[model samples]
Target: MKELAGKVKLVIKFFPYRYRDYSRIAAEAAIESWRQGKFAEMHELLIKRSPKLDRDSLISYAKELNLDVEKFTKAIDNQEGAAIIDRDLKLAKELDLYVTPAFYINGIKVLGVRDSDYFKNIIFKELENAKKK
Candidate 1:
């Protein structure tokens, strides 16, 4: 993101795998943290620590980030972020996305991980295509 800077916009959608025990709660915590303006911090903590995304752990993370622990807990407990997750999940299903690290460049779907050049190549091609039109 820092490298791309103003050239690209990042949009993250939640897709918690059904098999993972803490996936749904983690997604809820992340979303609630976003509501409290600490998405990045919570995301980093969750990712770095991982599997420790239980209710207490999430509250501790919120406190660590100086977020409103009460609101955050309520939001997660009530599953207030379910709407957004549901929407993303539906879209993922429609897109037939069964893998993590999927990306779409100018309506072109690319699944799984790839080198930086692979993404840059797609972005450059899209930019060139846009210039033609």
Candidate 2:
């Protein structure tokens, strides 16, 4: 994907499940990290340490990433990123998306887990279509 970075713009939207007790908080923490220019770092950490998204754990991760722990704590505590997360949730509902890994590539929807070959095929097809246009 890094090879296509300049050609493809990847936009990540948060759609944390309500049933997952720590989903919302983890989303908030990611947003906080985004504010501090550490979104990717925090995202990777959260994924690697799933089900450990307690406040202390999140703060510890932030500290590990050398982020401003105080600011991160305040943002999560105040739920500063709730609006963004809520908007994503609403969009997911409107799109009838109930899955974690849904993708919309040039209006083509691919849902569920897919392997690298699947993505490569999609991207190649899209690129060919783009060339034709």
Candidate 1 global CA lDDT score: 0.87
Give me the candidate number with maximum lDDT: 2
Question: What's the TM-score of every candidate structure?
Answer: 0.83, 0.90
Query: Following a full C-alpha superposition, what root-mean-square deviation does model 1 have from the true structure?
Result: 2.2
Model 2 bad stretches (over 4 Å): none
Over 1-133, each residue of candidate 1 has an lDDT whose tens digit, in order, gives: 4656777765778889999888898999999989888888888899898878888888898999999999998999999999999999999999888998788776788899899989998888877787799
Regions more than 4 Å wrong, model 1: 127-133
- After TM-score superposition, the amount by which residue 97's alpha carbon in candidate 2 deviates from its true location, in angstroms, is 1.2
Q: Where does candidate 1 have its weakest 10-residue lDDT segment?
A: 1-10
Model 2, span 1-133: residue lDDT tens: 7767757866889999989889999999999999999998999999999999999999999999999999999999999999999999999999999998899988899999999899889898888888899
Q: Please state the error at residue 41 of candidate 2 in Å.
A: 1.7
